[model samples]
Target: MTEALYLDNPYLELVEATVTAVGTDGGLYVDRSIFYPQGGGQPGDCGSIEWGTGLRTNIKNTVYSPDRSSIILIPRGDQDLPQLGQTIIQHIDWARRHALMRMHTAMHLLSVVLPYPVTGGQVGIEEGRLDFDLPEGETVERVSANDAINALIRADHAVTTEWISDDELVANPTLVKTMKVKPPTGAGRVRLVRIGADIDLQPCGGTHVKSTGEIGEVHIAKIENKGRINRRVRLRFGPSAESA
Candidate 1:
């Protein structure tokens, strides 16, 4: 199994690791990796790997192996592959990753502002969105929800993470907000992200900023009706145009 350095330090931009194995399609497997594999509605990280006298390979995407035991760093189609046993430095695209972290953390706050069961979500660089399961006839006031989300961001609440046993999570089912995707269990433990002292707490494996203030100015760009009870709320970076 590859050591997932990002889980412990999302801010880690670069790391030196040994090439442990090579995939059938030229994907590089390192003993340790800072690249986050795509999961939990977040996209995989893209960056470069450097080794031996300025030799470098552009990594197009990161993902897990078939058995999910190791992280594979996929190189660009035309890029050269690092040989096994080679020592290389992995560099994550920090700017892109930081934006993702901020957007992901904001998604958590959106859950709090709406206080509805989450059905799905997608975190992006410039925007993030969450689908909520609202009762029929219930409606979200766009401007007010937008204001509330911004207020939380301006609050500068600290974001922290902790580990809980799978059994403990099972005991407290309410800690999970997403109805369709459940936290990965059977691994003996699950990771939970908490914002502020009590702003929000739930099982999440995605990366996030250190504080809500880092989320900066955010606004609800749109609220779309997906189904009878599914409401999709889109959040964009910066303030709403009307507020500007």
Candidate 2:
């Protein structure tokens, strides 16, 4: 299995890894990876991998191998592939990843501001959105929700992560926020992301900033009606759409 360095240190921009194998279509499998594979509502990381002989491949995306053991780096069609067993230096597009982290953290704050069951969500580099299973006839005030989200960001709440056993998570089902996506449990442990002392706590395996303040200014771009009881709230970075 590949060591997922991103989970432990989301701030890491570069890493050294060994090319363990080459997959079909020029995918490079690495023994250790800082690139986050697409999962948990967050997209895969894209960057570059430099190998021996000074050759480098522009990684288009990152993903898990079949059976989900090692990480495979998908290079752009025009990039050259490194030979297996070669040591490679991996670099993350830190600016892009940081934006994703900030946006992801903002989504958590969105969940807190809305305080409703999350039906679905997605984290993006510049924008994020969460679909809430809100009751019919209830309305989310756009301006107020935007202000609330900004308040949390200015508060600079610390974001931390911890692990709990599957049994513990089962005992405290409230820690989960998503209705359709169950936390991966076969490993006997699940990762939890907590903001502030009690701002929000939920099972998440995506990358995040160290503090809410790093997210800077954010606001609700729009609230769309997806269903009779579903509200899709889109969050965007920088000032609120009205204020911007």
Candidate 3:
């Protein structure tokens, strides 16, 4: 089993790890990893690993092994695979991941700004979007949503994480906000992201900024009607198109 170091500290950029196994498809499985796998609407981390003889492998992407037991780091193109038990230092692209972290945390605030059931979402470094199920006759203006999220950002709400057993989560069903993407259960426990003392709380495995302040300036770029009750809100870093 690979120890996912990112879960403990998403800010960690590098760590020494031992290559535990190599797949036939040329993917490297390390004993530990800071690389986030592609899932939960977040793309996998991309970086490089260095080992003996000044050799390095550029990781093109990361994904879970079938059955989701281990994270396999796929090399860029046909790069040589690390030997089993080889010691190497894993490095994540901090610039890209930091943006992702900021965007992801901001999305949580977006859900709060709208306060609707999340139908779908995507987290990106440049932008993020959340599809919400709005109440009848309800509507969200881009400027209003942007202001609400920016208020939270300036408030600098503390972001924290904790774990609860599956049984505990069962007793509190409302803790879940996303309707389509269910939190991975049956692992005995679920990871929950809590913002501020009361701003938000929900089951999420995605990495996030340590505080809302780190998210910086963000704005609702657009709000599209996906259906009678579904509205897709897109968010971008920095000022919005209208403001720019």
Candidate 4:
């Protein structure tokens, strides 16, 4: 099993790891990883791996093994695979990963501002979005929601995580906000992300900033109607063009 270093420290950008196995499709498996594999609406990480003899390989993406037991680092192309048991330094694209972290945390705040059941979502380096289940006759005012989100961002709520047993989560169903995506279970536990003291708490396995202040100036760029009751809110870094 690969030790997921990001779950403990999203700010970690580099670490020394040992190559344990090579996948059938040329993916490299490491004993431990700083890379965040693609899942839970967050994109996989991309970076480079440096080995002995000044050798390096560019990682295009990170993913999970078919059984979800191990993390796989996919090379950018047909790069040479590192030998098994080779010691290497894993380096994640810090700038890109940090941006995604900021956006991800901001999305959490967005859920608070809207306070609706989330139907879907996506986290990106420059922007992030959440689809809410808004009933007919209800609406989300862009200006108000935008101001509310920025207020929380300025308040600088501390972001933290904790583990709960699968049974505990099963009892407290209200802790879940997303109507479509459920937290992974069957491992006997689930990871919950909490913002501030009581601002928001939910099951999430994605990377996030340590504080909301890092999210900076974000605005609701657009709100689209996906269905009769689904409103997709798009969030972008910096102030909205109209406000700027």
Once model 4 is optimally superposed onto the true structure by TM-score, how far is the C-alpha of residue 170 displaced, in angstroms?
0.2
Candidate 3 wrong stretches, greater than 4 Å: none
Q: Per-residue lDDT for 1-244 in model 1, tens only?
A: 8998888799999989999999789999889999999988999999999998898899888998887789999999987777999999999999999999999999999999999999999999998899999999999998988888888989899999999999999999999999999998988999999999999999998899999999899899999999999999999998789989
* Model 4, total clashes: 0
lDDT of 2 by residue, 1-244 (tens): 8999988899998999998999878999999999999887899999998887888789989998877888899999977788889899999999999999999999999999999999988899888999999887899999888888899899999999999999999999999989988887878889999999999999998899999989999878888999899999998877864686
Which regions of candidate 4 are displaced past 4 Å?
A: none
RMSD of each: 0.8, 1.0, 1.0, 0.8
lDDT of each: 0.92, 0.90, 0.93, 0.93
Candidate 1 has its poorest 10 consecutive residues by lDDT at 60-69
Give lDDT: candidate 1, residue 51: 91
lDDT of 4 by residue, 71-120 (tens): 99999876776889999999999999999999999999999999999999
Local accuracy of candidate 3 as per-residue lDDT tens digits, 154-178: 9999999999999999999999999
| TM-score pick, better of 2 and 4 | 4
Extract clashing residue pairs from model 2.
none
Q: What ranges in model 1 sit over 4 Å off? A: none
Model 2 segments more than 4 A misplaced: none
